[model samples]
Target: MTAMAAEIKKGRKFDQVLDGAREVFMRDGFEGASVDEIARVAGVSKATLYSYFPDKRLLFSEVARLECNRQAEEAMAEFDLSDPVAVVLHEAANRIVRFFLSDFGQQVYRICVAESYRFPELGQRFYASGPALVRERMSAILQPYIDRGELVIEDMDLAADQFGQLCKSDLFVRRLCGISKETSEAEIKRVVTGVVEMFLARYGA
Candidate 1:
């Protein structure tokens, strides 16, 4: 483990600190979140919080990691790998679209973009925990179909990344630009359908 990872001391209150930090970070972003507020929200003393996370950046990284892992796992849990390629892609597309439009997702994306220049590690962690993890998961899901000669994907990584971006569609842009809030299920389905069909048209064998 790296020095930063080693410095993190997990204990009974470890999850408590992460949960509190997630809430504060989501609400206030990276720079705006305060150690005092995190400690207060966690119901732990400053010393206790510090013992678990020596720096606020470390705490934020941990929160983003856990949240991203949780989302990726949750999205994969319902997936039936045995299903048709399009069916599975649709499921993945739906989950990705919803997540991109989620408040937590938007906040994390904004924080990473805003703080990444000053704290490069912050952006690296976000990409590793979020986009990289999702790409790996997508590749895993697609591999079975490729072996069966159902999907002809020579560049699995690029295919996975493309699928993710396709899921964004107009909805992600509109939401990010404050053009829409509270997207309807019909709208989400519209995007998901388009992504799966387009992706399959390109890669399906």
Candidate 2:
């Protein structure tokens, strides 16, 4: 095979390993998951799995990192900077709640919660790759509103964090505790609207 074909094959193998890692990690938490099982699931030999990821820790970290980035990207994609503040907040809340309810999102949270004590670095990895990024993105959006005197806030960072916490409280807790059901649209809208109204009342122009 040509060099290009070899690279393509390598890429495909990496994807296969990631897919298998996600499955194993979700089914058996990061601490309980094993590289042998992941390789078996991926239909690859242990050596092949190692070729893609040097160890189980690395593989699990990459899987969680990728999923977190994907969730953040999905949430960011739905945001419309030109929309009204209320509309923007509501849409952001919906996206956040939806992300927490996703399978990968819930599993990532489980891994963080379960393994944080044993592998404290995993917690930091999750926070840096996920919530930290979310907060940063949210702050960027809110900063414009604050600068334009549309929203009055002592701290845009705090406001963004509170907004995300409010939107995620219920779904995130439930999902972390093993509840797989999605939040109802009506519930999400009601909560988001209430939060947005309160925020606007406190900070609106």
Candidate 3:
């Protein structure tokens, strides 16, 4: 095959591996999932799977990374930092709730938590790619407001962390424990509005 054709084949194989890994991981948890199973599901030979991911651990980690990046992209895409604090906060909070309530989100959270005792690095990676990145993004958006005295935050980083926690805590916990049956649009609006009000009361213009 030509170099370009090889690259295309490699890309397609990677996509297949990711899809299969997600399905296997969600169904069997990290500890029980097998690379052979993933390869079979992906419709690729075990050699092909290994060509893309050396082992199951690397494959699982990549899946988490991709999911986190996808979520971050989605959250950041619609976000308009120039909006009023209330509007930004509302939109951000809604996005947070939506992500946590998603099936993929819940699976990723569970996988990290479940694998943390055996693989601390996976949990660390999850944090770095997921919540930590989100907090950093939030802080950047709020920094200008802080500088302008539109928001009265003494510790912008802490405020950003707290903002994310407040918006995601309830739904995240519920989903983590498998108790959250559904997340309604009305609930999202209420939670976002309430969190925004509380945040503003403490650190708004």
Candidate 4:
């Protein structure tokens, strides 16, 4: 386990602390957020907060990990793995696009990019919780389809990663660069449809 992970101890107020931290981090970002504000928001004493999280960075990383996992799990729970490959791929594409454009998702991406140079572990944790986790779950969803000969994928990891990249298309950069404030449903469907079509063209059996 990471030193940060080792230091974090869960308690009855763990979620409460996380919730407050998330709000502060989202509003003020990692550097601007203060421990005092977080404790005040959580309604916990500074001492209580320090017991659960010895460092502010630890608290921030934990919040990011939990939120990313929660979003990914919620998406997976709604997926019908038995559906046709096209249907499942489309669902995955839509979920990926929506998530990449979300406020929290964008913030996490920014934080990882900004802090990874100084704190390599921050980026590692983000990858483990976000892209790596998604790839594993997506690979599981696609494996049965590949076995049934609906998709011809020699490398499950590469194919899953490609599908994820396809979902990004131009929109991800547009949002990241602040060219677009909100992605409409119609825009999302356009990207999703293209991703599914492109992926199936390359892999369909």
Which RMSD values do the candidates have, in order?
A: 2.8, 6.7, 6.2, 2.4
Question: How big is the RMSD of model 1?
Answer: 2.8
TM-score, predicted candidate 4 vs. hidden true structure: 0.89
lDDT of candidate 2 over 1-205, digit per residue (tens)? 3211121125558898899988888788776788889999988989888766664655776787887777667767877777788888777777777777766677677777776777766677778877787788888778778777788888777887888777776656776666745577777677777778877887788
Error of 3 at 3 (Å): 30
The TM-score obtained by model 3 is 0.79
- lDDT per model vs. reference: 0.87, 0.74, 0.76, 0.86
Best by TM-score: 4
Candidate with better TM-score, 2 vs 4: 4
**What TM-score fits each model?**
0.88, 0.76, 0.79, 0.89
Give the per-residue lDDT digits (tens) of candidate 3, residues 103-167.
Answer: 66776777777776776666777788778877888887788778777898888778888888888
Off by over 4 Å in 3: 1-16, 19-37, 40-43
Give the C-alpha miss distance for residue 140 in model 3, angstroms: 1.9
Q: What local lDDT does model 1 show for residue 101?
A: 95
Q: Which regions of candidate 4 are displaced past 4 Å?
A: 1-6, 26-33
Q: Model 1, range 1-205, lDDT digits (tens) per residue?
A: 4334445799999989888898898888777899999999999999999898887877877887888888788878889989988889988998899989998787777777877887777778889988898899999899999999999999999999998889889998888889998799999999999998899899999
Question: What is the RMSD of candidate 3?
Answer: 6.2
Ranking by TM-score: 4, 1, 3, 2
